[model samples]
Target: MADKVVPIKEQKLMDVKLGQLPSWLAARDYSAQGIFLGFKAGYDRFFNKYINVKNAGIGGFAMLMTGYVILSYTWSYSHLKTERIRKYH
Candidate 1:
């Protein structure tokens, strides 16, 4: 008699503990193509449509960081100039 091999069907559901959501979201699932595609599309749409705050959340953070860097550089240059003047006097 020949042995029969039972094949397992691939499932879309990802298994994990309750507190592992961020890790799970970072992980890639090659088995669930449909679910992953849907999730990506939904996430992109949500970010595009639901993000109504004009330059006040993620964009605001980016702008603030840039402004801070620029202002810091300007301040450093001014402080160095003052130091040079004091040294020359």
Candidate 2:
């Protein structure tokens, strides 16, 4: 008798492919989830469709927004004031 291995299918959700993806990502187990999620989310340059606030929670969103505001303000202040400070006498 000869030994052989058989594969089993687990929890697969139905989806439609909008475009073709490379075979490498399909073969990679670790990256498969990310690829699936990215497609589901409609991965454009901006405006990602799958904005999961429930998963992130209010505090997480707040912190992220706060960080964005703080960084932007700092960048603007630095660029707008740098030349003025150098010229001040």
Return the TM-score for each candidate structure: 0.25, 0.27
How accurate locally, in lDDT, is each candidate?
A: 0.61, 0.51
Model 1, 1-89: lDDT tens digits are: 99554322322235444566555555545568868897897667656654645653676456557878999989799777877766553
lDDT of 2 by residue, 3-63 (tens): 4432222212232133323433354355788678756655341233224434544664575
Top model number, TM-score: 2
What TM-score quantifies how close candidate 2 is to the native fold?
0.27
For all predictions, the C-alpha RMSD in Å is 13.2, 11.5
Evaluated at residue 60, the lDDT of candidate 2 is 49
Number of the predicted model whose lDDT against the real structure is largest: 1
